[model samples]
Target: MSSLEKLTVDKRTLKRIIRELKKWKAPATVLLSLYIPPGRPISDVASLLRTEYSITDNIKLKRTRDAVQRALSSAMDRLSRMQKVPPNGLVLFCGEDMETHDFICLMFSPPEPVPVFFYRTDKWFHTEFLEEMVEHEETFGLVIVERDQATIGLLKGSRIQVLEELEGYVPGKHHKGGQSQRRFDRQIEQFVKGFYKEVAEAMNKHFLPLIEKNALKAIIVGGPGYAKQDFLEEAKEFLDYRIRQKIASELIDVAYQGPAGLRELSIKASDIIAKNKYAELVKAIEEFKRHLVRDDGLAVYGDKMVRQALEMGALKFIILDEDREDAEALAEEAKKYGTEVYFLSDGVPEAEWIKKTFKGLVGVLRFKIA
Candidate 1:
């Protein structure tokens, strides 16, 4: 929900693909090969648009292994030139090792890049056939600002998070409405202060259940008016440190509910965020640099810090900017170990919505924070 998504294919395209995949009622077994080729092909590199091709024919998934390999080789040859590979370069395997079921052929060509579904890879989603499987309920979140509101779309691997809206009380609502020169008595002013404080206290009470359930991940502060400001001042003592940090940006919009304001907030959530692996990690390090007040080298940069995080268990979590480029190694490394990851971009309606829903993006830490 916090950036890391692109609506590349329109609804029509998606509908068409869905229809086609439905028509593809094969045995659910597909051809698969790791064709090594005749001697590792003495070429520098080849631009065979890499992808997982799911070809279905009137043939058996297992039997077509050889023919599929040969066809792939042919396709590769037509696209790029190569030297010598092995006589029987590729090997055949079965089961989970072969993710392609009902496969006619599958290859990891780098040329044709199909966005593989890696659930939670960016935000929330895994690359799997959702057709036969029941679709899980998405973690929908909402954020309300004074002027606007927003709603978040659950992505690949998003957990069931909470969406909360805290409304602060403004005291003058119950008083006389006309142009009566009204001056508040000391008792009345005291009552107003108590009223505002009570409102804040009530909000805390409301969130107690959610916190107990741990259904929230982040909280976004937004609205057209000063509700967020008033709430922050009143609830400062009860606020989480990470969430306090997440309150840096203020919304200039107006809305009655968080979901209403989420739409406008998303527009401001797009900048300086990345979704791609190394780029996302690197961008976080860069932003992390700004938060370093003492700069005692505890706050550092480059692959060095990342490597340390990966090794010394310093990476409690990784923040990715939504505008990231390609990098597999860093993502893979994170998965190899147990580390939390998030992707965020500015100017997206869901960005603020996500923070509001989850309470803010802080995770279990591997090391102490400064």
Candidate 2:
């Protein structure tokens, strides 16, 4: 897959990137971040990488420059192979450990413009950018079921991952008759109960852990007929209290079953999905507005005040317009303070308002910053 196709910048991705950054110490490592704009010539990036590599050679170090040089060459080769850049462009992170002659690349097309920059630090690998990308991610669990079958999985942005599929014995509707038919009807009811119980058990086994970890925004269940609702009634017995509480919606009127039903349900419930993802951000913006109306010290805006709050370790959280040039630096500083950081994209109305009104940065303070 192309870099754009394979790359998904989410919370897990950020965690992995941060872990790598923390472990990558100096003396034997070289880190580089390059901005490859769309339709820009590969020769430009290659030339820049070569110049940086040459500069690294002159610096005093214990390890040989061979690994760094080889890594630069590999990055250049990879760039040359790309016919054109992705829509949002690419940010390439290349690192080489001289001791092991190991080279790694973490390349992706970021949602925001990644400023063209280079850094070779003891413990930095453009993790700030990763944080910015991850702040935009929203993930949730999805369940789709019919009478006899069900599919459970995760929804990561536009991607849908099927985690498990389950099938159970569901008999047809019973017809009216005498005593013999009544006994047969009771047997069918028992079978239906068993089927619902089995489906609920599968969901409990697969989805409960995610709910317990608080990894999902919510669990959205959908299926044809009353099966979705019927399964939830059984799930209450099988699933944990926390897991049961996480069910945001139980949808009926779905046409398909299994994986196909999962995808269809995603489309049908796009609004609810979007609401779950953006609700917190929207509320935060509203709270910031309330502070503004009251002229409270608890909320501050503009790049200067936000940075001041970060320096003082007074920021509870901060929001930045995705288009802001200084967002990456602000995010890095905020991370040090253990402050929550959110990147507001242009599509969001509040984000657009902030972009026009606040010069692209805002912070909710832990206390008055006067």
Candidate 3:
């Protein structure tokens, strides 16, 4: 299957599955993880498992042999039921937790095609491949440029990473008189121009590949004073046209110029980062807040109120912080009522607000529910 294919499974569900699978453990390497890519013949996989099952007999310990064989049998049984591989692909995790003696056979038609055929026996289910499929692949380039210092970063998913920090020596303003002052001014201009080129080089190095991959959605630039504008103006000559064109139109004004400034730029560029996943989440929270401030019956929060709203079929949309104890259960319940569900990460301030003020779950009702 093509890597460009959209994931067939919901991201939340995939994440939940990964979390659940990660918790299961075995004392020995009895856990089995099987990955069958799209277009592979199920019969061939069944045969392979049968062969593996026969090979398990060579195990020295009877207990280990029994566990491995049972897992292989379970995997074969699952394949026997499937007529063919799913469009995206098939993933099966069959294992016996030796410590608990509890068995699990989980199968998934992943959100994306399984990259290759793989099988493993280990203490835990191999979920790295599935985890990759759920990762937020698209990213936004963040650039904070000032005269003396600049920071370049990437906003990927809900996290921000500082890629490079550059410092420049553009000596304090010229205080001398006549020829000396003019020379100093000329030297300062050269230093500023050189600094801008260095920033451009970093931007090109970091953002160009993302652009080529079509993963970079846009670039946001910010800084204090006219330095940002000056950098943008001079960037046309030193920066790649592709990178220049991707720069957001509304350059932000920020007080700081390093990691802190990158974050400030992110918060300020909400409008420009419209396509960003975190921005979408923040927007949803803001909408919920608006409803709450107006005292509209449409907004409901806290465990009791949100649960009641879900039960009464009044919920139109809901946002739950994934860190909540019952978040997964609430998400499942919300889905049954046809309510749209959004999962928020813990670090986002808006998400934290919902967690602290609203008990980590909030819903908008389709109609006021008394």
Candidate 4:
């Protein structure tokens, strides 16, 4: 399948571009944003820009007219070099930096296909379409159930949202007499069944809409001991068939039952979450850790060492905590060497660890620089 159909665009690069473009602005409506979807004829866009350049002469302010014409010229010049639209399409943002008053033009193929053709001139670069590409619209349903308590949550992007919490009462095993003990056991079983049913009802209520929207990717069910197993068994009857079908084949064993259990379930279900952006970030951090533990020359951390490696063209991949003041500068420098760059979000434990231990910047070297 094409990258557009799979929706697999390099999100890290897209985010970096978005962050960079958002900073450029003009005092007047002189900033130009153009989006050309795949299959568009570059010549058509060039002709349109030429017409726009001609129309700029009618502007009341000379400065605004000059800025608008310059931005349009920059865009047209960019399109002239492109033989055709890229697989994912192209985006161009050209304007005057309000602070520096320097002409600025940024162009790239977005990670995802531009859904429509658009062109606009505004004070700020149009980023709404790019923002949509980064939104975590798809979600995973999290259900952690045990005998006494259960928690249902949703893992959308990096955030986990608790949807419902339920509590139940099931008496422990009885030893009073044979008949009395048997009756107590049956009562306990019934209570457990009722709890499972309650959990299922909540799931159906919350997840059915997501399923219908095709936004629910999967459901992960977990808890301590046989309770999880029992739920899966009873799921055939208690859970909606749609939810039951969505349940991941791998059920996790978690010690806690409430919000804590949901967190545990997310970590344990790494195999399932591997496709997620947060999971990918975790994996990258883990890889860096492995190289560090091995004491291999391939691993380097801290600003000084990472910069040295980048200068030598030996850096293969670099991870920078987004909170670091110099992250954008370091990322730009790394890009000069064609190195892969990843910016870790603040507040993530692994990201925080990198910030605290490695001073927020790290790199994996292409070769031993020493």
Candidate 5:
């Protein structure tokens, strides 16, 4: 499957977390902390918080170590009591407080040959971990994040990992303003095509290995000015269906710096999935399938069947065709039971609605899947 094809959050793993987040009393507080042998420096935790997190003053640990200790106590107590943690919110932990033996991190290398990493909060220490992991989208289960220009990984309970890092190679001319230069400025234009050629070569080299690991998803060419465009055209002939349509390949503009390239690539990745719309269809199809096979809070088509499912409390989600005028009656019924309804319109492109119901079909469910 393509990278876009595998972006689903496993419902079985997330159901409990969803349930608890919904049932927990209002004014809910999210707890972020670190678990140590109980003797690690509180400043380690404090500096970790000071660097990136911003909560209310009541949550700060600057002058008062006890404040940090108290928050840790509360979060752990809540974590242990609960069977699961919600994905909708984030909780941070660091230093000794984060060293729980069970902590695990989930890291994706986009290929198997590249090492896969996750965080082990209980076993190790890192300050900015949780923030980085969440950037990968919802495929990961419960965890904290950690990444910077050099590192990217997560801590589910405590899985440590370091993703493969490839620097963006630049020939001398690539850093300058592309190929725009005059004979008087010939020294600056000395390395025009060669610059992008090197970038293109490096990119091809970086992404080609994924096929060996069955992980090649797409090739994106990006850098400012003429460099990316030049590279794109140079690399155009090679975007075979395997990499273009099948692997989600593309060539676009992005910063030449390694870190900036990744951020821009992430945004482009999100756009590729979002603008394409097929990803949503694929997910909706799987969600419906889950409903059919596992009774995981979904019902489909017809008023009687939907209500039967809802009354059985078997349904947590409702899918409706916007074109169905009679939808009003069914919508009212589904809403009465706290069912979440999403419009599946026939007027929209059929490709978009293929996974959802149309022609008066509807889905009813018992819970929400994010």
Candidate 6:
């Protein structure tokens, strides 16, 4: 058995999956969303997949049943032999045909647990939940700086997208005589000034637009020492006050300054990253709570209430705890009712509060649901 690193589904991944779903044309398809709890045995999920496959034989749709079964079997075999299932959970899609063994197997782990279930259908794959996951993602700009170099990137959920790298000249202070050293220092000061100017320009060009557009929530700056501080000071005049205010964290211990630096910065600023990622979800939960307190009938909670709102075509939006096993079904129903869905990640404090208070399901209604 081979273990694979579990990856969180990001915007790029979700977009690619959506493209694949749009292009997928098959006689039968099997879509399995399995929840792999942390520290739980993989055999449990594998056995469940096997049992679910066994029941697919009774599907009266003769033309597609066999193909669906083959796809399900392939999915089961793949799941059973895995040494590690994603700690978050896995969603696997398999397309099979009896005539040609050209099967399409696609698997990705969500950033949070998705509802665990299996569905064999000839229609297009269910992806509302994934779309919701992508919607809740908050993008942040990442900057890692050194005296002579800097790296800029975008962080959306668990994915790090490097955008640009900058390098400049900063002369060393090691001249022989005092006069010579003074001259050398003057030249170095000039170079550092020019370097900071270029850095400010890069920041304005690459990051400011996203901040202005509200696509990016915050910026995390990190570096080895005073370099980061110096760069921030120089760039401050160029960046809008609003954008500068979005600077959530500054790290002084990052030793690298390129792509590796961006990665290292991500690790060093994990707390800020998590906070940015869940900030929007937390805001949405807050709004839901406001509605609840006002008794405006604009919000509803609990599994039963949310499902009822969905059935009545009254849901404007649905917020679900990703850990809830029934979220997938409810999200699918919400989609049919033309309601948008958002998954509340457990990493956020408000999400845990919602789970404890509302049984992890909530809805904003288009109108009173009584």
Query: Could you tell which candidate, 1 or 6, scores higher by TM-score?
Result: 6
Candidate 3 lDDT tens digits, 267-345:
8887777545566577777888899999978888888898888899898889987766566567667767777677786
- Between candidates 1 and 2, the one scoring higher on TM-score is 2
Alpha-carbon TM-score of each model against the true structure = 0.34, 0.53, 0.50, 0.45, 0.36, 0.50
- Per-residue alpha-carbon lDDT of model 2 for 1-370, expressed as tens digits? 7656654353444455667765654465556556565556667767777787677667564354555666577677777767666665666767676556566776666555554444443334656654644554456778876667778888766667888887778667666789878898888767767877776677678777665544566878888778788778755776777767778864646787666777887888788876765776777788888888888778898767887878899988888775565565666667678787777855578777788888888878989967
**Clashing residue pairs in candidate 6 (N, C-alpha, C atoms within 3 angstroms):** none
User: Residue by residue across 33-91, what tens digits does model 1's lDDT show?
Assistant: 23233344434223321332233233465544444444444445433432433232322
How does model 4 fare in lDDT?
0.81
- Off by more than 4 A, model 1: 1-162, 165-219, 267-280, 283-370
Error of 3 at 5 (Å): 17
Candidate 1 has a TM-score of: 0.34
Over 180-209, each residue of candidate 6 has an lDDT whose tens digit, in order, gives 888888888778778777877777788777
Q: Count the backbone clashes (under 3 Å) in each candidate.
A: 92, 0, 2, 0, 51, 0
- Cα deviation at 338, candidate 5, in Å, is 38
TM-score for model 2? 0.53
Model 4, 231-350: lDDT tens per residue? 878756867899888888888888986677788888888678654546556777788889999998888998789888898999988988755656656766776787767668654578
Stretch of 10 with least lDDT, candidate 4: 2-11
Q: Which lDDT values do the candidates have, in the order given?
A: 0.37, 0.69, 0.83, 0.81, 0.39, 0.71
Q: In terms of TM-score, how similar is model 3 to the real structure?
A: 0.50
After the best TM-score superposition of candidate 3, give how far the Cα of residue 180 lies from its true spot, in angstroms.
Answer: 35
Give candidate 6's error at residue 310 in angstroms: 17
Worst 10 residues of 6 by lDDT: 28-37
Measured over all alpha carbons after superposition, the RMSD of each candidate to the real structure, in angstroms, is 17.6, 14.2, 10.7, 12.8, 15.7, 14.3
Best by lDDT: 3
User: Candidate 4 has what TM-score?
Assistant: 0.45
Kindly report which residue stretches of model 2 are placed more than 4 angstroms away from their true locations once superposed: 1-135, 171-176, 208-214, 250-252, 277-279, 292-318, 325-349, 363-370
